[model samples]
Target: MPRWGMVIDLEKCTGCQACTAACQMENCRLPGEMWQDVLFYSEGEYPSGKLTWLPRPCMHCENPSCVAVCPTGAAYKAENGAVLIDWERCIGCKYCMIACPYGVRFYAEEKQKTQPDIRDVFPAKGDKVWDPPYKMPEQVQDPKHGVGVQPKNVVSKCTFCYHRTSKAPTGLKDLDPNDPATRKFTPACVVTCAPGARYFGDLDNPESNVRKLIAEKRGTRLLDQTGNRPQVYYLAGEAPVIPETRSVRKPKQSPET
Candidate 1:
C-alpha cells in the first residue's frame, strides 16, 4: 500500500483562501468550519512588520494522538496514511480536537467563532445541521469515512478528500491536480490551490513528486517535537514554524492602588 503525503511550497503560496472555499463546497462543511485554513498573523516592529500566512490541513500523523484519545474508536489512521474520524461512531467528545496541535478539528455543536450563526440563516431541510443556499454536490455518503454532509453533533476534520483519492488508478504514485487525467480523483483543496503550492503523492515511492520535493526542498513538519510524525511537510527558504504549545488566558490585573 502507498503511504500518502503532501508537500506545500511556502514560496509559491499566496495565502489565498481558495483551498478553504473549495474544501467547504466539496466536503459540505459548515460556514465557519474550515478544513483548509490560511492563518495570517503579523511579525516584527512597525518598519519591519510583515504578514505571514500559513496554510494548515490535518497533518495525518503516523502516530495520531487523536486516534489514541477517541473513546469510541472514531478517529483512525487509514491504511493509506490518512487520519479520519467516523461520524457514525463519534461521540462529539472533542478529545481529538484537544489532541491536535494544528487546531484543525471542528465540533459544530459549539457556536461558531464568527457571530450571527449561518446555520440559522440557512436551515437544513432534514436532520442535517443546516442546509446551504447552494445545492450541495452529491457525495459517496460513507459516514464511516466522514464522506458526506455531516450529521448533527459530530466532530470533523480534513480527510485529504478520501472520496476522490480512493478512486485513483491503482499503483499511481502522485495525484497532481494539474494533470487532466488525474484531476477527477484529486482532492478539492489540492485542485483549487491557485498558486500550485500543494502537492500530493505516495511518500514511499522514490520516484514520486512528494518524496522528491521533500528531499530537494528540505521539508519540515510542525511541532515535530510532539512525535506525531506528521505526513504533511512544508518547503521554503525559511520553513514556516509552529510553536510547540499554546493556550488562551486572561492577563492578571494589578492590585488597585
Candidate 2:
C-alpha cells in the first residue's frame, strides 16, 4: 500500500499565496474556505528581518486524530493514506474539526453564501430566473472523487486532489514526483507552485523524491508533541540571511554668518 506524503521547502517559498489561490480555483471553493493557506510571520530586527511564509495543507497523518473523534464514520483514512470525509455520512458534529491539530477543517456553512455578482455576470435565461450563466466544473459531480457542487453543512478539508491521484496507473501504488505519470496525477497546489518548493509522492517508496528530500533536508513536522505523526514535512532553517543598512544622519549645519 502507498503512503502519500508531502514536503514543502520553506526556504524557497516567497509568501506569494499562489498555492492558496490555485487550490480554491481547482476545488471551486467559496471565498473564505481555503483548504491551502500561506501563513506569514516575521523574524529578527528591522532591516535585517526575515519573513517566513509557511504553506499549510492537510497533514493526512499516519494516525489521524480526526478519524478517531468522529461520532460517525464519516472521517476515515483512504488506501492511499489520505484523511478523507464522506459528506453523506458526516453529521455536522464538529468533532473532527476540534480534534484536528492543524486547524485545516472548516464547516461547510461557511461557504453557503452566493458569489457577489451572480445576477450581474450570470443573468438567468428566459423563463428560468434561477439559472446562472456558468455552472460548476463537471468533475465535481463524482462523489467518489469530489465533494460535489454544494458541500453544505458538512465539515470539509483537502483531499489531496483525489480526482487526479486516483487516476494513477493500476500497478503503481503511488505517483512519483519525477515521473510524467506522476506529473499528470498531482494536486493543483503541487503543480502550480511557482518556486517548485512542493513535492508529493509515496513515502513508502524508497526512491521517491518526497522521501529523499525529507532525509537529505532533515524535514520537520508541526506540533510534533501531539504525536499525530503528520505526513507533511517542512524544510526550513536554511534560508539565506539578509544584511541590514541604517541611514546615516548628516551633522547639523553651522549658524549662518
Candidate 3:
C-alpha cells in the first residue's frame, strides 16, 4: 500500500500554467473550473521586490478538515492517503468548501453542455483545427476508471489523476524507472511540466524519488501550523533581497536666494 504524494520545488517552478492546462485537459474540466492553480504573492519595494509563485492543489491531508465537516460524507481520505469525493453521495451543501484551508474544493455550478448550434472542431493530423459534428452535453470522464460522468452537483478537485495512474500497464506504474512506453504513469501535470519541478510517488517508500526529494531538499508542507499533515511538500526558494530605501533630501533652493 503506497501513500501517494507530490513534491513541488519552488526554486525550479517558473509560474507557467502548463500543469494547470494539462490537468484540465486530462480531466476534461469545464471552463473556469480549475483543480490546480499557481498563486502569485509579492512583497517589498518595486525595484528589488520579492515574488513568490505557489502552486496550490488538493493537499490530501492526513487529517482532512473537509472530511470532518462534510455532512454527506462526500469527502474522505482514501486508503492511499489521497482525498477523494464520492460525487453520488455529495449533496452540494458546500460544508467542505468552508472547511478546506487550501481553497481547492470547487462546486460545479451547472452541468457542462456542448451547444449543438456551435460548430465543434479538433486538431486533425498536422492541421491546427478540423470541423467536426456538433457535440452534445458530455460529462467529464476519468480515462483510467472509464467513468466519464460527473454528477450534476458535487465538489471536485484533483485526484492526482488516479484513474490514469491506477490503470497504467504493469511495468509502467513507476515514472522514475522505466523503458520507453512503459514509463508513462506520471500524473497529467507531472507529465506536462517543462522544468520537471513536480515529483510524485509513494511517500512511505524510502527509496522513492519523492521521499528522497523530501530528505535531500528538506521540503516543507504548507500551513504546517494547522496540523493537517498535507502530503504535498515544497522546496523552499531563495528569497529576493530588498534594498533599504532612504528618503531623498530636497535640493537647496539656490535659485530662490
Judging by TM-score, tell me the better candidate of 1 and 2: 1
Q: lDDT tens string, model 1, 83-151?
A: 998988999989999988778898888778776788888877676777776544655767789877778
Task: Report every candidate's CA lDDT.
Answer: 0.83, 0.72, 0.67
- What pairs collide in candidate 3? 141-148
Clashes of 2: 0
lDDT for position 196 in model 2: 83
lDDT for predicted candidate 2 compared with the true structure:
0.72
TM-score head-to-head 2 vs 3, winner: 2
Q: Write the per-residue lDDT of candidate 3 for residues 109-210, one digit (tens) a residue.
A: 544355332213332222212222322123434422212334545677788777645545543224542235533666778888888888877888787888
Q: Which ten contiguous residues of candidate 2 have the minimum total lDDT?
A: 242-251
Give one digit per residue, the lDDT tens place, for model 2 in 1-257: 66788888887878788899888777656567789987654555556655545788988998999999998888899898888888778778999889998889987554236567433354444422123323445555444433434344677788888777767765464464456867768888988888888888888888877888989988888877777899998888566321111112322331211
Candidate closer to the true structure by lDDT (higher is better), 1 or 3 = 1
lDDT of 1: 0.83
Q: Output the TM-score of candidate 2.
A: 0.80
TM-score of each: 0.90, 0.80, 0.75
lDDT score for residue 176 of model 3 = 46
Task: List where candidate 3 sits over 4 angstroms from the true fold.
Answer: 110-149, 168-174, 177-183, 240-257
